[model samples]
Target: MTIMVLGIFIAVLTFCLELYFKEFVIQHFHSIADQMVDKNGVEPGNIEKFYSIGYHNSLIGLIIILVGFIPIYGFPVIYGLISFTAVGVVAGYGYIMDYDVIKTMMIAFVPHAIIEIIPILYSMAVGMYINKNIIKRLYLKKNNTSKLGTMCKKGMKSYLLIVVPLFLLAALVESFITTFLIDRYL
Candidate 1:
């Protein structure tokens, strides 16, 4: 209960912060996009396509981490597994394309990646907790809230309090870390 409450607080606070700094966020994203394009020698069209793919991938991670509440116990673990696997695959692809360049890119990214991944892990932990309740309700059908209305409301609140903050933290880590790394290393 306490953890859930804290998550909710963090999520709401983060959401508000994101809104307040919307322009800054946009500028940072533009910079990152520029960097990726230049470093990869991607054309404008290809850059757009790659960005779209990345956006979809991010959405997938967000959705899975959010909907993971449906399963309860294994949801977070499964989400983590999938997320890491996806990262690994992408990293491998990057390496295959240009190993030395990719290694440099990874170094440039590691500082921010550490911060960005923390919130994701936190969200997965929350999702796992919710998943446990879902499984309990499914199998035991005991001591559980049965109404869809109640569940939806609860789920929304939980998501708002947990997942939202995580998204914001990721943005922050990306913005600040990327800027710092680029100025220092690049």
Candidate 2:
């Protein structure tokens, strides 16, 4: 919840920043956003493209879970911030293209972005939980192995069952529904 709000703040801030420093933001940050926007919309019948998106999204979730084991309590927070910074930059660049911010968000992002964000944030939460426990055990001398093991087990179960499926669904929505809306409305 905190990370999601922060991401939105970063995105809105970036949008406002882009409004003032359009040239600078575009010069430095537009390419990433452009690539994301461009690659997001695949040909209507491209199963391969949909699979590619799902694969990448799942890979990201997997990495987030792995990152949780790093024994750094704030590592997941850093990852979330870095991930959302790109989102912010993307939002900012969309403004530069003369797209109404609300319309673009409503049409292009609101549908699948929420679906996509949930798994990523949940993955981060899982990572943060594991990382926090490990840090407590290792650095704070908590000596709670059983608790840590239980947490790990839970994280694994949720990741395999929940996060992976959500990513696939989000990818499907993004590749099909969101893309169609973008073409039709935005």
Candidate 3:
């Protein structure tokens, strides 16, 4: 129930942000894409191109979720591996930067991060489903004019519904939890 509420809140927040600050968000995404392209060799292009790449990349999270759901080797094992790896990377980066702030930020982030990250993972899973079918129709079979457009439109609607509110809820959690924890514990 909490998860559902959080997801809805994030989705709504994302929608409102997009509506009021579309250019800002787009610019941010463009900057991030540019950085990624420079650092990771992603191609440089317009928003649509970046979105396509993003949609495909989101599949990795979906794959993780799927792997996590396997009966014998499930979410716990997968999560542990990911958590360990993330911690290692963060630690390495912190060491390189000679900054304890990263650790402090991580501690502050973790409480709300779980609530926020799950919806994003779920959204990516949903996006990947749409992307896979589009890829199949457009690339593999060389059938360009299929029902993919319709599917994509529907998928975008669904994504908007899920992602916007989830992000808002995440923002709320981030704002409130950190302050509350600090006031109580510090």
Question: Residue 20: error of model 1 in Å?
Answer: 46
Q: Tens digit of lDDT per residue, candidate 3, span 66-143?
A: 342233323423332342233333343333445563554465556756755665556545545555555565557756
Ranking by lDDT: 2, 1, 3
True-vs-predicted CA distance for residue 114, candidate 2, Å? 1.7
Which tens-of-lDDT digit does each residue in 66-100 have in candidate 1?
66556556756555545443344334334444446
Model 3 RMSD in angstroms: 15.5
What is the alpha-carbon lDDT of model 3 when measured against the actual structure? 0.49
Model 2 CA deviation exceeding 4 Å by range: 17-21, 24-45, 145-152
The candidate with the higher lDDT, 1 or 3, is: 1
Model 1, global lDDT = 0.54
Against the reference, the lDDT scores of all candidates come to 0.54, 0.79, 0.49
Number of the top lDDT candidate = 2
- Top-TM-score candidate index: 2
Q: Judged by TM-score relative to the true structure, which candidate is superior, 1 or 2?
A: 2
lDDT of 1 at 61: 45
Ranking by TM-score: 2, 1, 3
